[model samples]
Structures are given as C-alpha cells and as structure tokens.
Target: MNDHDLLETYEPVLRFAKSERFFPMAVEHYLERCSILPSGPLGAAGLLFHLNEPLATFIGKLEGGQYFLRFINEPLYDADA
Candidate 1:
C-alpha cells in the first residue's frame, strides 16, 4: 500500500465529550487567536507574539529557543456564563 493509504488505515479515531467546546482548527486561525511564548528554563514566560500574526512571521521571530502557543489573550469558551 502507498504511504498515504497505510497511514490512513492506521489513523486512530478521536472522540470528544459533548461538553467540549473546542476542536481542531486551522493553524492560521489558531495563530491569529493565540499568543506565542518561550519555553524552557532559560526562556522567560512572556508574550513573544501578542497580535494576529501569520505563521511565517512568527517562525521568523524564533531565536533557536523552545516555544509554545497560548490562548491566553482570548477564551475558547465562556466558563463564567
């Protein structure tokens, strides 16, 4: 079988709870809604990209350090409601 067919055959199914408010989304949409942060011990916990920036621009700003994305600037769902 081809690589694509093989991988697809082995792909696992995912189930989500009915109460789940979030699901997989496009990287562009996710990047626009989230902020980038530096990870690891030497990396300070701060916002590296706080605005709706593109993935290419964000990658260019990386300085060979471990980094992660956070949805701190916005809420995925209204928990207080």
Candidate 2:
C-alpha cells in the first residue's frame, strides 16, 4: 500500500489505541519499538495488530498459539500452516 493509504488505514487504530477504554499498553509499547524497525517488518506488525480478536483467534489455528505473535516473530516463515 501507498504511504497515504497506510497512514489513513492506521488513523482509526491509532485513535483506538489512544483511547483509555481500549488502551492496550502492549500495542503502544510495540509501536514505540516499531518506529526504529524497517518498514516491512513494521508493516507486518501493524497488520497483525489491527486484526480483531476473532480473526486473530482464527489465524491462531494456523499452527501457532497466537497469530499476532507468530506473524511478527516469524514473518518470513511460511504462512502455509
């Protein structure tokens, strides 16, 4: 995706992350780390972060205990499951 599209897509996620109710500190912590990482890995992390719980749970069925962790930790690993 283009930079503008990427930025636009993250707008809502950012808002949610900032909100006190849905405030997941781990996500914010990861964002801080992601700032220094290369774009590709950051993008993958961001994609995983945006996945809702049900979707994340579904992805976990792909031979990983958690989709977000697996996706970010082993992105290059075949997603074949």
Instruction: Give me the candidate number with maximum lDDT.
Output: 1
Candidate 1, 30-62: lDDT as tens digits: 777666666774344323443555654656555
lDDT of predicted model 2: 0.44
lDDT of all predictions:
0.65, 0.44
Clashes of each: 0, 0
For candidate 1, the per-residue lDDT at 16 reads: 98
TM-score of 1: 0.49
Residue-level lDDT for 58 in candidate 2: 36
